[model samples]
Structure formats: structure tokens, C-alpha cells
Target: MWELRHRGAAARPGGEAASPPREGEAAGGDHETESTSDKETDIDDRYGDLDSRTDSDIPEIPPSLDRTPEILKKALSGLSSRWKNWWIRGILTLTMISLFFLIIYMGSFMLMLLVLSIQVKCFHEIITIGYRVYHSYDLPWFRTLSWYFLLCVNYFFYGETVADYFATFVQREEQLQFLIRYHRFISFALYLAGFCMFVLSLVKKHYRLQFYMFAWTHVTLLITVTQSHLVIQNLFEGMIWFLVPISSVICNDITAYIFGFFFGRTPLIKLSPKKTWEGFIGGFFSTVIFGFIAAYVLSKYQYFVCPVEYRSDVNSFVTECEPSELFQLQSYSLPPFLKAVLRRETVSMYPFQIHSIALSTFASLIGPFGGFFASGFKRAFKIKDFANTIPGHGGIMDRFDCQYLMATFVHVYITSFIRGPNPSKVLQQLLVLQPEQQLNIYKTLKTHLTEKGILQPTLKV
Candidate 1:
């Protein structure tokens, strides 16, 4: 059954085998065709037996608390798949949006936890796919090693985050200080242990398949854990940096679906057959506008614009800082063409709102490629969805494939353009240094500043 499924998946959509017989092999084509037909008959008989099995043999879809309400289900029972899917997606989209807002209101810590949870779920979903496809469940220590690697990777990332952002808190705790000081080395050691375990557990017959799953586990970790770490990093920069990009992706997804549902005429891509040019175009404009407005509104609140910081005194994370120039309103003279339309010569806008254009544009334009890549992956595996975690959304990974891509872009954008040398981060590092080393660094900085005329030189007296 597994071989048949894999063979079908390997075949091209054009009804050609993945590897056709060579020209030189034409003499044996008749024999090959006869053998292939015999194999097909055997496959058919096996499939018949499989389908004849009792319902109990089939796995049930995992129950979700957020399944469609029965009343709405009845009302939509008569609708076609297209219309029914539209309603399901729309309703669940709003529900997820509401949950997102609630998490935002709860603050950055909650947001980080949420990201971590999503990362784990995505990792699980992908690893589960590997297990199902390769039948690797019987492999010794494979599951254990996969989870061990996940822990090692997460420990490395979150440890760095704590060391960078919670230096003061770490300083207060001697245990945490030691962990933070050698975090990378510890992380590497942990991973090495897992690696040794994997080597030891390798079976002679399954060596190639075991290595494939090992690569699969690492790739999944790279996608889910590494990208999620970046998302949290963006959040720490400022809630606006995180929220705007994410919300833009969500907006584009919804607006695109709505437009495509109503006006789709031209197909956008082969991987995602349902995507259309109308949706793509409509989504772009809607996302940009939505991002602009969201940036403007979020900029008004210092809480949204301030970088998140860990306060040892307060014993919790805090978002409190002087708003940066990015958030500050600045006046710009309108172009001659637009002056008449706006009936004004100048307009006041937050610079971040201008940056939102790039974010929204990437979210709408390049972001869909992430989804396309995921779709291709699913097609390769002959799966409809990753899992039925969300009633309409398939899995956490399905909804977040584009989000991971967007988070990466946002992190790059901040580092490349917006972020400067952070004095606080430097100070945090300095605080971890020995007293004599800190004094030397302070003296060096003071001397440099004095030479530069930024600080007055003191007399030896």
C-alpha cells in the first residue's frame, strides 16, 4: 500500500512516470509494460481489500473545539464545495483574528508563548507527515531524537533571546548567568548527544531512510523554530514591527480569497489552482492600505511602538520607551498631482507608515510563494492538508507558512534599515562583563568621546 501510494505520488500530473524508459531500452518495452500491468493488478487488488476494511480501521479526524456550529453547517449543507469553503474560511478567519487580537492585548510575553506553541505544532505536523510517509514509527529512537533536536534548537534560540534581552534578570540569578554565558556551547553539546544517539540507533536496512528523516527533522526545525525565533525578535523590536507585517499577511489572505471567490477568471499558479490574478491584485492593494492605516493607528500609542524590555525590578517584561522618529509624525509636502486630490499642500504621517508599503508589498507579492511551496510539498506527498488541527485552515503550519516568510522579511528590514546600534543591548553586554573589564571599556569610550569633543576631558588633579 505504501509503495503504491509513493509510486502514484512520484508520477507526473501529465500521466507520465517520473522516469521514462530510455530509448535504448525500447526492445524490452513490451516486457516492461506487461510487468507494469501485472504490478498494477496486484496494486488494485490490495487497494480493494484496503477499501473493504471496516470503518474502525480508518483513522478519525481529530476533534476540534472550534468546529463549525451545527446551525451554520445545516444552513450551508446545500451549498457547493466552493461556496461552503468560502463561508468556512471566512468564519474561521474572523475567529482566528479575534484570538490574535486577544493575544496582542495580553502583551509580548503572551505573544512569544503563542509563537513557541505554533512552532511546536508546525514541527509536529511536518514530522508527523514524515512518519506517515516513510513509516518511520518503528525506527528505533527516531521520534526521541527528533524531539531532542527540537529542544536543543529552541534552547539555543530562546537562551540567546534571554541573554540579549534579559541580561539584568540573568545577572540577578547566578544559575541563569552561567547558562546564558555558555548557551551556544551547551546547545551544541545537547545536539551532539542526539546525533550520537541517532547514529547508534541506525539499522543496516534503514540507513538511507533514517538519514532522510534526520534531514527532514532538521529542515522542519529550521522552518518552524528558526523563523519563529525571528518573529519574536521582531516583536521585541516593537509590537508594531511584529503586528503590522502579520496583520498585512492576514489581510492579504482574506481579501484575496474574497476577491477570488467573487471575480476569479484567470488562474494565478498551478501549485495553488484556486489562486487567481484578480485575488492577487485585489489583495495587494487592500493589504497596502490596511498596513498604512494600521501603522498610523499603532504609531499613536507608545505601547505599540516601544521596544519590549525585561525589568528585573518589576519582575516582568515591559514595553516602555521614548517613541522613535519612525513613530513620530512628520510633515511631507504632497506632490503636485496629488495636491488637488487631497486639497492640501502637505500631509502629516509617521515614517513607519511609509515603511509599511514595503512590508505590505512583500506580504502580498512574495509571501504567497511560501504558500505555493507548501502546496507543492503537499502535492509531492499526495496529501490534501497537513492535518485537521483547524476546521478550515488545515494545520497551524498551513496558516503560518507565509507568516514565517513575512517574519523573516520584517527582521531583515529592521536590521538593514531601521535598527541602529542599540545602546541598551550594548549596556546589557557590558553589565555582564567583569568590573575591571567594564571600567576599561567605559574609560575607552570616555577617552574616544573626549577626543571627539563629545565629552569634556577632566584634569589629572
Candidate 2:
């Protein structure tokens, strides 16, 4: 029976063999005494019929589309299961790299579109799961209400983005100007409309399910959409902000898998059985080095180092700026041990890359807990993956489970530690105000400047 189970586990692609008995549990040993014989017989009685069944009694499982390739099938049949997984993962990695380069070449706008696209897909996967679970409950307009809420939220966020970043163009259109003027009021109205519709659609028996799904959708929005907005904010700071943290997570994920595949033995956590301590530690060092190197390479490019600024004269997002201290190379004193071993007194490094070490460490440590959280969610729902959007990587949510957490961390880190006053954004906001409001701000600024002696009192009036 044990041999049959082992053979079945080996035949499967993921190598989920049953765990062996611990050190003292061998058959016919002193451990199985007469006193325990009755208990053992009761266990056998419960499942003894299964041992009599032949292999023919079990139905053969059909092949999936993924296993249709003859070469892959033969390799899986011949090579080690780990090797087969490596081959598939390697191909997927290459494909992802190709897509990444293509998007990067297309520039920041394309990357924004890609992010928005992923957000929509992730939202779809999550909402679909909700629908599938509650479909039988026969709730009225559940999916519609969820989508309406999504639209309302997106309208509010995107409307804010346009008003803040595209102030010049917005002033040109009377309709947009009016909308921007009453943006907050209009957004609130839209949300209220959706809320009313949901309340009206609530059926008597399905009220509990409807409310549960409502909360689920909102929580999903908070988790996926809100974090994605932060990611877009990171992108506006510089593509590097969006890229480095994301890349660091991806690097950590890949390196962890690689290390774990070859070296992992002891399980790291109950939530994810495949995770191991060896992988976590190995991935940490590798991600740190990779993050530093990537940050260094990106700092040299103006396209990455400069923030995304709108130029009214050119009517486009422009990248042009003197490199900030974060990107500039600065010397740091080395430790005494390093100074003695043919090392220089100081090492020149980009301050941004130094920060990348913190980001990478978070990605390696705390970021994965986000994935584990998703894993627990899936287990509770009895699903394998979120959605098979990526052939090997599961859903966008699955792939970006860590990235979302990393994105929020990067955004907060920048806002708290790195970001300075964005005179342009502030100026844009000021421009969006009414003429009277603008005048008040102008007077306030003038008065402040005069008090500071930057503006002469005689020239003011």
C-alpha cells in the first residue's frame, strides 16, 4: 500500500509524496505492543478494505493541456520532477523577461497601462471567485454592483490623477474644468448612487451573502486597487521606484525557489509547506546583491532617475532633472576588517541602492507573508491557484502578492524618508483652485515670502 502511494506521488508532477513514519514507528516493532494491537486493529478495520483494491480499480487521470507537448511529457517521464519544473519555469522566466523589455522600451505610459491591465485582471479573478462561491445564493446584481463600485472607485482615483498632473490641459476643456472643480462632490455622488443601487437590490433571504460579498469586494479593492495606486505613485516618482522594488521581489521569489528546489529540506511555515528556511536565507543575500546592482545600473539612466513631469509646452510627460542625492554616488567609510584586506578607505555607492537593501530585505522577509496570506485564502476556498493568467505563475495576484506589499512599503518609505516637496505638483494643485482661492494662496505666499525677507516690503504693494 505504501509502495502504491509512493508510486502515485512520483507519477504526479509536484512530488507530493506522503510523509514517512517517524523514527520509532516501524511495523512489527516493540512499539506496536499487544496493548496497542486492538487500537491498531480498529484503525485497520476502518480502512482495511482499501488495501485489497487493485490498481485497475482506480481511474486513470487525463492529461492537462500543459502536458500535451510530447517533449515535455517525455522529459517529465524520464528526468527528475525538479528538472522538469526547472525547464518550464525557465521558459516562463524568459517569456516574462521578453515582455518586460518590450514594455520598458515602450516607456512609462505603456508600463502604466500594463499595471492598470494587471489590476483589472486581478480584480476580475478575485470577483470571479466571489461570484463562483455565492452564485448559488441567487443574489440580485451582485457582480454588477461589484463592477459598479470598482468603476466608481477608479473614476475617483483617475480623476484625481488627471486634475493634479494634467492641470494645463484640464483648464482648456470647459467640461473637464467643471468636473475637476467639483471632483470631490461628484465622486461622492457617484459612490452614493452605487450604494443606493446595492441597497435597493438587496433580497430578503440573500442579505447576509450580499453583505458578505460587498465586504469581500471592498476588501479586495483596498488590497489590490489601493496598493496599485501607490505603485503608480511610485512610478511617477521615477520608473526606478516602481521597477526596483518589484524586481527585487521577483528576484527574491525566483532565487528562493531555486535555492529551495536544490537545498530545501525543513519546512519553514505551516501555511506554505514548500517554503523552507534555507530558501529564505539564500534568497535574502541574493536579492540584496541583485537589488544593489540593479539600482546602480538604473541610476545611470535619466529615463529612470528623473521623475515623470508633465511639460505643458511639449504636451507630454518629460524626464529631465539633475540627479538627486539618492541617485548620486557618495562615499561611505568601510569597516576596519574590510580596510585591511586590500580594500579602499571608502566605497562609492548610490544612496538609492543602499535603500534598496532595506526594500529587498523586506521583500525577502515580510513581503512573502503576503503570499502566504493569499495561500491561506486559497486553501480556505479549496482552490489550487488564484487564476491561471500566467501559465506557470498562477494569477497576477499570485505573482504580485509580494509586489503589492513591497509597493506599499516603497511608497511609505519614499514619502517618509526620501521624497521632498514637489513644487510642480503643488503648483498644479494651486492652479486647479478657483480664481479667488488662487488669489488667497498667492497672497499667503507673498506675505510669507515678505516676512522671510525674500520679497521686499516696498515692492509688494
Instruction: Name the top TM-score candidate.
Output: 1
Which pairs of residues collide in model 2?
none
lDDT of each: 0.85, 0.81
Residues 228-336 of candidate 2: C-alpha lDDT, one tens digit per residue: 8888889999989988899999999999998998999989999899999999999999999999999999999999989988788888778899888888989999999
Best-fitting candidate, scored by lDDT: 1
Question: Which pairs of residues collide in candidate 1?
Answer: none
**Residue 267 lDDT in model 1?**
99
Error in Å for residue 255 of model 1: 0.4
Candidate 2: residue 38 Cα off by (Å): 59
